[model samples]
Target: MSKSLLLLFVAVFCINCSSDNKESDTPPTEEPLYFPPLTGTTWKTKSVESLDWNKAAVQPLLDYLKLKNTKGFIILVNGQIVMENYFNGHDAATNWYWASAGKTLTSAMTGIAQQENLININNKVSQYIGTGWTSTPIDKENLITCKNLLTMTSGLNDATDDVTPSALTYTADAGTRWAYHNVYVKLQDVVAAASRQTWSAYFNTKLRDKIGMDGSWFASGNNSVYYSTTRSMARFGLLMYNKGKWNDDVILNESYFNEATNTSQNINLGYGYLWWLNGKASYHLPQSQASFQGSIIPTGPNDMFMALGKNDQKIYIVPSKKMVVIRMGEAADNVNLALSDFDKTLWTKISALYQ
Candidate 1:
């Protein structure tokens, strides 16, 4: 090649090299999502001004929460309590039932049980909980797996009020139907049977104590309910916000954590393992078989996932916003088994705060 041709090639090569170098020199794009220190009640906070939020927009949220009968409301920004309030005679030390939101905790404990190899979620429920755990025929009952319970696809009839295995009447085959059922609590039994420890003992040792969370499970008639201070609920949200890691301790395996938060089945795009997910194209409401279009909490950040419960109890984790928010109280407007209008309305007010 001629010297002129060689020079031309060299110029082109240099340009390409410069382009590659420029791309490489670009800084990492992820926002600084902060996590608080492990093993302490003391958590550092970031102010609205510091975080560039519209400071004046927060008061409206408090008023709305109060009007909606919210007992405890908390907002943890980057692992700190940016806002905390209690109303209706409720205080910080008060223990409130998580209701269905505690299902998320059950989901986490199931994942932990799987992580220890004490049980496999894919195994038949009968394998651990034993046959006749459901009223279905021997063969149909065998089809139910822990995964089905996690995904609320147990195929067990949920129209009835009974929550026991005998009352878990069969409808469709497992993995074929998705119906929100307390059959998820059966997971506690599975973990217990597999680990040879009661669900409360197993969960306390594996997660609660390890993360410095204060809570306990109590029998609520046919089902058990978890009660804890609002702050303790916030701590669990932060734990999940950090993907099951507390400082250096890996309380839950990251892979399982992802599975628990992401869409677990095709039936409900707005649901994970016992968690309500935002940004999905469609969602399903409890006690309803209809599938609705659009995100569950449309006003909230797209990446938010929540442990939502009856009477509007909520533990919302927004990864995109680096926040954990919780609300515990009586029914907001209406008594329901799970998510209500309060979710969207409250989030709309919250979005205004960030505006």
Candidate 2:
């Protein structure tokens, strides 16, 4: 072997080795988010330090919530509890009302029912619930569909205080209007009739039992409301954070879950089927005719969508951060049935804590 030939061969080998080293040094991709299994009363947990969070900063956020009538609060990252708090004698065992936050649960169950081929959301409400479900005549009632109920676009006159069929009169075609009305209760009935089971029974079977959630739905006059422990609410937020999955089980359909959390109608960019979404150009507050000019929760994550309810029940999900936060308690501010200024203040405090 000549010296020149050997030197050239050595340089070629060196080049190949450098290329291989570069390929192996590329950074590994981040781990995909995961959820805990639905098993015993205890759920998996993670420390704030696991995410490099400043623990000292969390106390101010807690103190603020305590002063603002909050009873229960939980924040989960990657489906593990990072913070679970209760105030005013409310503890892990206390079951509280989800208020309109339960609307998100109903929407999920509706999606599951549709997934099971029980009833299509786009189908007319009269089809499953039978005719005369609404005060509207045959022609008008035919225009009102299950989707309308879900989207709060049923076009029924929400001006009336009474919830009867006659009081829930039709003033316009379905899908043409968005009003936060108690007429949403009819959706549960529609699901019930279509599934041949009561709303509570179906929900208990399809969702609660499947997710190890111990919650009960009870009648509150014209509405059916849900009551559950703060952890149960956190479990629900986790199920949604994983995009409708409970560990290995696919409890809610993926495609349906996406639509359920994103904007569902042109009228309200921050409202999905029944959930409240954040990071939209604008949003509408319940019982208000005006559409505000910003995300419902300005300080929360841009990707966070929420289940906000009357007198301040909340379930917040941030897919970008693999986070699910829940607030189940009394009113933080004198707001009606939707997002409030307190949402901004609390989230702003939380943002500081995570820094």
Candidate 3:
């Protein structure tokens, strides 16, 4: 109870409190932010000719969607936002569901694994997730591979949960035929198991870090991960346009990027790794039998490709044209709305600029 002792005690307490405050002030370490140099009036409305569209026409297409309730849409040309529009109270920053489009991210991770020498796409899924990766019948498990999952040719239909066998079983065998299903979902665990890191961690460190993607992982709790804002989706498309290179960094291995973007398997009309190819030869039809024909509207060349999602989350990459276009929003059950027409129309308006 002496004065000197009490004073010393008080001073020690104050120092401890100050130290705690300083520690609290320090920022948490996170993956650094990647701000791509993409902004300004180009994204805003401007003269069609001023922007370099082969034949830029969106008004008619916009008119077509006028009566429909949709989320948002963005259009970028040669890595620049040539046109952007929003609906349903959504904005550029809104995070819409990429659905199947997010699958491209998964496929991209596979490419990253190849770059790091984790595993090869030609490797069987069993090699990564172990034997019986799919909970399907015994016959189906033996035939699955990373390539099969990415190309949608795993031959195991998702009618019943492929993860949970209590659901249903549709087919067996690998290259017998093709049907779009959730069989590829199992690859998430396979990739994570092989890399020995959580899918989120692996993605953030491997892919997101390279391209400077700002989107968060959508499926956080259940081992499912997909995400992106319209702009982020555009950046992914641009990465593909740049052949998996961000600036000077080779984000994706050139060989893997080439095969992943090209038609890995011909199951669907146009399918590369998780990405989709759009060409006259593309035999796959949107849920609705939409046809994309014409020039001027932004589209992939005979070699053009795309990353398409369930709700119309699209990253269209055309190598020959040197163009990347991103469209994100609800397109009615992931159906293509005048996609063929839009591709043709936009190209017409954009083509004038090029000439």
Which residue runs of candidate 2 sit more than 4 Å off their true CA positions?
A: 1-34
Tens digit of per-residue lDDT, candidate 2, span 1-355: 9999999999999999999999999988875565556666676778888889988888899999999899999988887788889998899999999988998888999999999999999999888878876788789889988888898998888886466777878878888878888887888888898899988889989999898888799888878889999998988988888888887789999999988888999998888899888889998877766888987888888899888888889998988877888998889877655677888998898888676
User: lDDT rank, highest first?
Assistant: 1, 2, 3
Backbone clashes under 3 angstroms, per model: 0, 0, 19
Instruction: Give all candidates' CA lDDT scores.
Output: 0.88, 0.86, 0.64
Model 1 score (lDDT): 0.88
Pick by lDDT: which candidate is best?
1
- Alpha-carbon RMSD to native, per candidate: 6.5, 3.6, 17.5
2 or 3, greater by lDDT:
2
Off by over 4 Å in 1: 1-41
Model 1 scores a TM of: 0.89
